[model samples]
Target: MRMPQGKPGRRAAVPPWLRARHPDPVQDDPRICPDQTRGQLGLFPTPPRQFARTHAARISDRTVPGFEAVREELRKMADERQIRARTIWLWRLEGIARLALAARDPDREQVAPQALKDLLYSGPILGQALHRAGLLAPTASHRLVPPRGTGPTRQGGQRDLDLRGQCAHCLAWANDRRVLCAACTSWGYHIRKHGGGEAECNRCRRTLMVSDGMCRMCRIIVAETEVDTARIAMDYGDQLWFARPHAAGLAVGPRTSGTAAARGRFAHKRRLARARAADELQPSEHVLNPAQLELFPAPTRDWSRLNTATPPALTTAAADLVADFFAYMRGRGWNINFFRGSIRTLRILTGHLGADAPIRECDIRALVSTGIHVQGARLINYLRLRGLLEAQPPRDLSVARARRSASTISSPAFAAAVHTFIDVLLGQGSTPSRPRSSKTIENYVATVLDTIETWIAQGLGDPREVTKKHIEDALKPLHGDQARRLHTALRSLFRALKRERLVFRDPARSISLPSNRPVPAGLPSDRVAGLLDRIDDPRERLMVAFVAIYALLPGQLVQLQRTDFDRSKGRLRLRRAGRMDHIVYLDEFTLRLAAAWELHRHHRWPDSSNPHLFVNRNTAVDETGPPISTAAVTLLFQRVGLPAGRLRIDRIVDEAHHSADPLRLIELFGLSTASATGYVLSAHPDRKPGPIAP
Candidate 1:
């Protein structure tokens, strides 16, 4: 025998060659000489294959009963299985087979008795309790046992029966005859019947039926789930499923009630309604803060002196409230400064309830008057909070009016006189009910006379009795030019009177008086250079320069002259420039231009005033200005011979051809579209201004 070699550390395994060669003294003929036999057999046969030989012999021995009979017995066994499969199975003793099928394969309950037991149970298609928990019971073959970690197991625990399975009471006595599982103890049947029984419905897996039936929509959407007619294997609910809210009600309670989900719909609806207008108006702080200055009413008196006086002291809370209100309005894109809306509310409040809005209500009417849209809704909100908004409308204001009649104006003469002149002044019967200045009154008188004469020829002498139809007739004969002017007057008056009780109730209560517009001011040419030369103030010189480069009015330039400039950042602002108080931005050229002029001029402005750059000095002589009159500005333009009549109306006073070519300049500066560019159309000393793009 050959000894195996091994290292000192490891004892070597014995080689197979050394163990047994069967002592073949010689390499016996490759198969006993290919055909040689021992004794009476012609074949030496292959070396015994022990297990195979044993099985074959047993198979052959069984044939002694008679080959055909053995075959018949095998057939009988197979036929018996087939017969058992044909009939419906009624469960009997709970065994490993039954329990395993119940766990790993739910459909096994309805399958043929002989359908491959383990295959049917462990099949991918037949799913039972679908969860992290594993099989109900281990199968007869230990290999078929389900993986662990299902619900706590008790079948093989210490006690005869555990809390998870059969309990002590289930036996009734010490070791009573039977040991049943918890399911069998609780109900006569196993959990297979009590469980949801595949209770999922396509319409609502979350829903359960009150009487243990399908949910309402489920019944409508899922039909005929019998196995034979798997004809209707469904992935989802049928088409045309019932709608929500109503559909949600169906899930109320198959076995338990849940009405909260249904109630949630109403809450969601209310939330949506309140938030619908949240995105309506939102303005940035930078834009609104500077612009709101224009929103303040032109003070009842010249506040030029008032500006020097200290503003009224605000209470800390009042100040904070005002700050926040300004912040809030700016956030909503409003360039509002005065409590115009709030004070109007104050006015109304003072009118009603004697002196103020309920302190608790804090007023909203002011916001509305300022062109903000939220006040009506805000008023409604507070009233609701106060438990008053939802209350029925109060008995008509007429009752209140009757009670207050003593204060009512008794003479019709004042109102009537104003009414009779309405047609002549407004070119119609009524104008907006707005307060007017002496200038507005004069304009009104001039326009009224014109309208009356024109109407008289068309047969309308008195506008007091003029109905809408009659006014239209009177308006028909006027040219578009005249009609447009009349419309403007009417529109202006109506907007102003919207809040007045008389105006709200009567369309005719509008103001017939014309607008007392401040005659737009500008400096004259002969006066402008003279005025500029006289001003020694560097600040005012810078201010004049800005007015020239950017068309800003005097007051507008004054308010915007402080820390906002950043020479490095390249931005300049015309803080507030219009009735709307629009904030205007300028590029770096502005800063450099102002700096250059200041260094060269060596002038200084009033020491007591704000860092504001401008101050008018010689206006009393002709127009009250450090420079010149509004009249002077216009006359200067006329002398220069640029298109004067139209540009003045548009407020675009300065013009230079950005492109040198006349036609190109006209096109680039937007001259073709409106009156603003008309300068390019006129013959110019030079072709135009700047280099053309093309």
Candidate 2:
């Protein structure tokens, strides 16, 4: 019954009972060293020096310099878990040994935690065992806690591997009963796969990780190739649907670029698809109808709404009012999509308010203010538009403050004078024939403000302190149109001040503005040609054409409505603010572009109540919305790398070159006498007027 003990530095002898139990222990288990022995009961084996020396020797030859401690840690893990010696040897050779050799830190005694986890990811049982035995750090184990009813040594663990139920594809929380999140499911397949951490991408010729010789971007492109190619094919089927009338008679030039042509046709198809799917003209199930209320399905659970402690119910009267509002919207030609969104928001709002309470604007604002119902703005709009809520909401004071803060003038007297000057420009007595436009008033105010701010900075406080020298000094730095504008603004400001007795003299009156106009220069012909060729958007193409070909200003462009075009006569009657209407006879190119844009507009918004020729998604929903803003039109021109003003000037100057008659320019473009004469002088320098006879 005694344990076997070997001589110092020598092997232990096998006991008689152990030898009888297994006469060929080494042959039966290769992991059993020949010099080791078991106890009399054949349970725990006796410690032997040869066993440690042999194991250490095997690991020392294979592992890095300082990671010999890993072998001892592995032995401890195997012993604590009662793992079979053969299994321990297999784990060492297969997993742990590889990790030790792969250690990036050569001088550290233990392999890095991340290295261990990465090596043991596929085998959770071994990872947990090593973690329990203290060989692997807690964080080093791939699975720190085994699933219920599973042991550290047992296999086939059925634990959910995802982190917080997140999807493997999108990294977003997966919905119940699905592999991918809702957004990922809706977007279809777009997963990017990266392979081994080394290799060059075949497509982009960049050094990056690749799967099947394709980088992530290249793989994405490949996955989307089918969809893109199909869309392109669809575009090609309808090439001449908006072709110019005279295109057949003209000598053919190079075909439109593939990118440009595909863009235009695809845009048309997309608009058509939207119109078909809008369901505005289709018979819709009006769930808001009182008769259908009994059959309507309950809305699905919204987590945001569930955050409320006690959600209220919709009152009978309030529900009826909301139903009436929906009906009013329907009568006004709003699409079902607007109805669907409004209903969801209204439902949230009604639940936030009590069952007995009527819906009120102040109450809705309170709910939004307290963050209880953030989606109540659209609901408010619906109620207000239906006339059930007539009173308008209070304006945002913060916006008013921000606007006021833009005027940073310091001197009180000078600021008052500037304010008075603005009032005079907007006075009731101003004639309608020469009324100042908002832009012109803004420019006048801006010029006066700048001059006053400069005077204040120079320690002059009163408008009376400004002199002829000050006016001349201000006009010194500015030249061309800027100088003329400054001179005009100063003269007007001083005249108003002198008339009001706020100043003694009008210093700017004697200083005459230079009348020389700068010669107009056109953008490069090649650049213009390239821009026109690349213009793929129907609306933008038309906008640019109006500026480049017909010389329409941005102000005139935004004023155009659907009524301006004369379809039968092929003419566009451009109505000016204060001048006679200038008629443009549409050529084959402009006509086709106009037709395409009209078709696009019709299909994109079949139920749109907007009357403007250019309507976007925002304006299309409202019945009485204004045309596209001046900023939006300017942005359109900017995107095409051409200024609208430059285009207009170039077109005007080009027209003048064809005919030097000022009257012709005036009649054709509705230009004033001075503007027409300036263009004529610029185009035909030989026709310059002789010196005036005294």
Best candidate according to TM-score: 2
Which digits, one per residue and each the tens of the lDDT, describe model 2 over residues 181-206? Answer: 45444433332322245466555455
Give the per-residue lDDT digits (tens) of candidate 1, residues 52-161. Answer: 22222222212121223323333444355565642222111112223222222222223222222433333222222211123223333222211222224347654322
The TM-score measured for candidate 2 stands at: 0.49
TM-score of each: 0.24, 0.49
- For candidate 1, the TM-score is 0.24
Candidate 1 at residue 296, lDDT?
54
RMSD of candidate 1 to true structure, Å: 31.5
Model 1, runs deviating above 4 Å: 1-446, 449-464, 469-482, 494-570, 576-589, 596-612, 618-639, 643-694
Off by over 4 Å in 2: 1-312, 317-381, 389-408, 428-435, 480-482, 498-501, 689-694
Q: List the residue pairs that clash in candidate 2.
A: none
